[model samples]
Every structure is written in C-alpha cells, then in structure tokens.
Target: MLRALGLAVLLAATTIAAAPSASAVTRTAVGGGTGIIFRLKPTPETPTSYYICTLTAVGRDSAGNLVGLTNAHCFIDEQGNKLVGERVYRDTSPAGTAFSPAPIADSRPDLETGAIGTVTYVSTPNNLLNSGPKGLDYAVIKLDESRVAPTSTVGQVTITSIGAPPANGTRMCKEGHRTGLTCGKKLGTNGIWFTHLIWTDGGDSGSPVVSGQTLVGNAWGAQHSSPILSIIDAMNTQGGVGAGFHLAT
Candidate 1:
C-alpha cells in the first residue's frame, strides 16, 4: 500500500460549539437512506450518461451545515452535466417512525441521461464543489439552506471531535449507509499520515471515520486496494478536500 508522510496540526480556529450534540447523531440505514449518487460514462466512445446510485445522509459540519458525501468517480460525465448530481429521498415510514427524510426543495435542473430524468427529491445547489482527494477518490457537496432542515427518517452522523490522530493499533469504527456499522483499528499514524486495514468497498467512500462522536476522517482510498478514510487534516493541508483552500471549520 502507498503510505504518505505528513504532520497533523491542531487547527487554531476556535471549535464551533453551537453544533448539534453527540446525542443528536443517529444512523438511519446502512447502504439505504436517501442520498445523491453519481454515475459515470464507461468510455469516451459511449454516449455521455449518468445515473443516481443510492441515497444516503451524511453528518452536519461544525456550522450545522449538512454536506453530501460520495465517490468522486461517481460524479463524472462525458458531455453535458458531466458531474451527475441529485437529491436524497427517504422511504416513507409509518407514523412515529424514528427515521425520516429531510425536507428539501426541488431546485435541480430538469434533464435526463440514460433514461433517467430530473431528480426532484432534493435540490442541487449551483455552487457545489468537489472537496475531496483526487487520488483518494472522494467528493463532498455542501447542502443548501433549503435542504438543511432535519428529516424525520434520516439520521445524521456526528463529526468526531478533532484531536491528534490515533496511534498504530488503536481501535476505531465507521457507520456508513452501505456497510451499516463496522469496527477496525488504527493500523498506522505516521505523523499526520497513515493507513488502516479496514474492510470497506466502493459505496463506502465519503463515510466518516469516528472515535466516539469525533470526526477522525472520511473514507477515501484503501490500504490494500480496499477502502479507507482520508484524514480531513491531511487533505486540508494537501489541498484535496474542503473548498477554495478553506478547511472545514
């Protein structure tokens, strides 16, 4: 596995305490919830097309802003709308259900590709940016104000509190829409860079790596060609994740 060396630094910015408490974080579904998915064209010769893969809910940032996380390759296109995007729609549940879909306005453009038409469950913001590692293969989209409202059925993941990276062999866990919830350990933490031997796959990218409700990192690429979470600190310093050179607050 390719191991990169970097130093982890404490962000000087004051931690945003106004964010939701750890108890607010919840897991609605595994590999199921309402989230945006991207479909890429097979080859240059193939007609440009895209499709919605799955719908899942990510956690809100320190600012109480909900961000959409997914695979970067999933957002590619050949012609128009190369970055295929859509909104999440939770399956309607019975009354008093614990999980529900967030309220999102129809703000996405009406179009079609590969027989798929306009996605109306959630609106696609005009300023969404690809805030993830190019080689790591992840993408993040900031949810607009109109879509930030809490959902009755959609549970949110809490960003783990920022801290020094875990030492080698430290135990950790991840709750993703695909793999449900699984546990692993910190295999390496060389300076601010390292890799883990966690078991993850394609749909697992963009899932948050947590140690108790604190945000350690988001799943990026894997160590053994599997899947792994790319530490947000490393990505911020390396200029992979976050927008306009701004790190997550």
Candidate 2:
C-alpha cells in the first residue's frame, strides 16, 4: 500500500495553528477512495491510457446511484464541455501501476481492471480559471460499485457534510493520487487556497480537501506549488443548479 509523504518545508508561508479534533475512519490499501484517474475512449478501438488526476471519493447521486468525484478538467475535451457518457477508470495505485503490473504474463491477473466508471455530471464550464462568483470545476462519475467502493486507501473518510469555505490560516489537508496526503493552512482569500506546503502533481487534481475528517472541497487547480480547491458550498451550488443534484456527504 502507498503511504502519504509529508512536505513540511512547503508550508512555511502560512502559520497554521493546531487544528480542531476530528473523527477517525478505516480503509483498505487499494480499491478505495483516492485512486488513479483515466479517460477511457468511447470507441471499440484501443483506448488512450493517460494519467489525469485522482478520484477523490465515492459519492451518491440524488437518485442514490454510486458516483465518483473528480475535477471537471479531467473529463473535458478541447472544446470545454465536460465529456459525458465517457468510460473512465480509477486505478488503485497512485502511479497507475495497477494498470500494468510487472511480469508481462501476470499483468492481466494482477491488475484490478474492474474500476470502470462513467462521467455522469459536471458543472457548467465557467471562469474557473479565477475565483469567479461560481465554482464549476468539479465532475461526478457514476462508479461501478462491483469494483470501487466508498472508501479510501490511506483510511476511511466519513464525510458527514460539506463544510464552509475555510478561512486564512485554517489548517487542512488533502489526499491525492500523486502526492498522497499533505497538510497546510488556508492562504488565499478570494477562493479556497492551501499553503504551498501541501504538494500536488499533474495527476493530483480532483483530490479531496478536508479538515478534521470533514469535507471541505476538491482540488481544482494550482499555482506556485499551492493547490486550489473548490469551496464545498460552491460545488454543492453547482451540483444543484447544473444537474439538480447535491453533493453526497
């Protein structure tokens, strides 16, 4: 199982105080929350395999269907619209090693290929580049529960409810496929921004941002080594306004 690495030096910019106590949860090493993201092609032809981001968590739609939360950019095409009806796969390993294991003959048997999911809903494309009035960079993928469950590899995360936008210096952390878990204080005021101490990579987008086991937001974009997260309320707002849905706690 992959464990999270700390990036202490990166958070020097912010003064994070002792955080409020949070509850605990349990999870497995693989096939849980926070996994490799992939964009499966629609055609019968060979699917283009590429690492995009992390599948933040297993969510439930308003209709009670299982779903996966991720960044809208992960499912968007060049034209800007989130790719709907696309087959996506969230592999167990952060490095996507589950897709291709060692020993060519053992690859098929060793890899967990049942992590297939579909893009069900995404917030409308808006000025997500900046902290606009709307935060619309999240997407939901209806997961095939036969494979992926509502759990995390590092540990189980009991998301009781969406949290308010974090204030500056509010201690928080996130678990990403590429960087694992990293903690820092909130920095930006325009939107939700964590201190530069928390690390992220190309495949770390869509990761879950939390504070003491509570859901805060999802990784949207980043700059200067600091990851930008969409406010949970904004995500909830978009989910309702765009898809008539609510964020699954």
Candidate 3:
C-alpha cells in the first residue's frame, strides 16, 4: 500500500499569517479531490534550488477543455522571476520517494503514484492602474500529456464556468502541496469580491479555491488586519473591483 507523505513542519520565519490557519478538517481521498501537489526540481547546476507549489482542479474552460488553476504569483516573484516550471515531483510517502520527471524514455516513473506536469499558461500581472490591483492572480497550466495518462496520480482537471458566487456560509475546499487537503466555508461574496475563512498557510499560496466544480478564486493575499485575515478576491481589471478571469468558456 502507498502511504501519503507526512505534513512537514511549517517554518515560522517564512510563514505568512495571511494564509488560512491550521485546522482539524477531515481530509478527503486523493483521487477525486480538488487539489494536486507539485515539486519543482532544480537542474544539476542549481542543486541548491528548490520549488514546490499546489494547484486546484478547476473544471473545463470555455472550449470545454480541462484546465488546472492557480495563483499567477505562485509561478513568478514580484521581480518577474520564474518560481515554478523547471521540473516537478509528487511524493508517494514521507520517506522521500517521489515521482519526478524521467531522465529518459521507457524508464518513466509510475503514473499510478504521481507524474510530472508543465506550466502551460502564465498570466502577466496587470497593476491596478490598468484594471485595479485586485485583478485575478490566476494562471493556467497544462500537464504533460504522457505524464497525465489516465492512470497518473495527478488526474485530469476541469475548468469551471463563470457564474454568480456561492452563497455565504457555503462549504469550500482546496488541495495543496504542503497542507495536503483541507476544507472551509464561504464567508461572503459580492460581484467579483469574495472572502473565505479557510485553514491554509505558507506554501498554500497559488492554491485554487473552489466551491464544487466551480472555480471561485485562487489564494492570493491575506488580510493583514485580522486574526487570520481573509483571502482577498482578485479584481477583474488591474485596479477596479471585479472577479478574476477564469478559463474562457
């Protein structure tokens, strides 16, 4: 039997309070869940480098194609440095055995455990001046076809159709690399404005926030004013208040 990896101790020094707080929410089974964990591997010349991130399995886009959603900030830094997309891995257990990008053909890692994926589309950060700063902090990535075979651990993801936000107090959930799986509830929503009180943390950024098959939002900024400041909704334009963009249907 394959064992899931144990939760790693979060680092206090780099931890962000804006993330959801820890909780005892029941963890759902992996295969039909909402999130997938991916680890970015550094090249031999960059052995000291490390990169890991999470993604939400949003429904299909406008064209009816499957798409995975995540925060654009998760892929790059404020300085425009690529933070994701070198090579990624998913752990099979806490023992460190992982399914990473294979070095050659025919020797590929088993997909039933987990397989590698690639960063397909990364959105440019448009400052509020263009549309307002709260715009969608989201991006779309394409999993490697061979790695994403029917039997792969990171199964196909679906992009949600745009629609009205979920009612207040509705249940929500997310899958993340660091936290594994967690659940929460909707606190409020108005137009593109949304706020949720999920139990996520650092490495939890870029996680997709979903309500059922609908892609509600992505984890972007945390409230600095509250105990667990809520996740702010991405504005439509760069600066104006509106809902973030989803895969065009």
Best by TM-score: 2
Choose the strongest candidate by lDDT.
2
Off by over 4 Å in 1: 1-35, 39-66, 77-136, 150-157, 189-193, 221-249
Candidate 1 lDDT by residue in tens digits, 1-249: 111100011222222123234445433332212333333233212313323222222434444444444444344332324343443322222111113212212111111211111221121211122332224434455544332333323234444244443667876655444443555777874332446765544344344555555545544345321122342432344342232222223
RMSD of each: 15.0, 12.7, 13.2
Q: Return the lDDT, model 2, position 172.
A: 69
Supply the TM-score for candidate 1.
0.45
Instruction: Return the candidate ranking by lDDT, descending.
Output: 2, 3, 1
TM-score: model 3 vs. ground truth: 0.51
Using all chains and alpha carbons, the TM-scores for the candidates as numbered come to 0.45, 0.63, 0.51
lDDT by residue for model 2 over 166-242, one digit each (tens)? 67777767666555566677675433333334455556666677677666666554521112234334545556322
**Residue-level lDDT tens digits of model 3 in 71-134:** 5555654356654453433333221111332111111112243334445555443232334344
Error of 1 at 154 (Å): 7.4
The TM-score of candidate 2 is 0.63
Q: Candidate 2 vs candidate 3: which has greater TM-score? A: 2
Clashes of 2: 5
lDDT of each: 0.35, 0.47, 0.38
* Residue runs of model 3 more than 4 Å from their true location after superposition: 1-46, 58-66, 81-115, 124-132, 150-164, 189-193, 212-215, 221-249
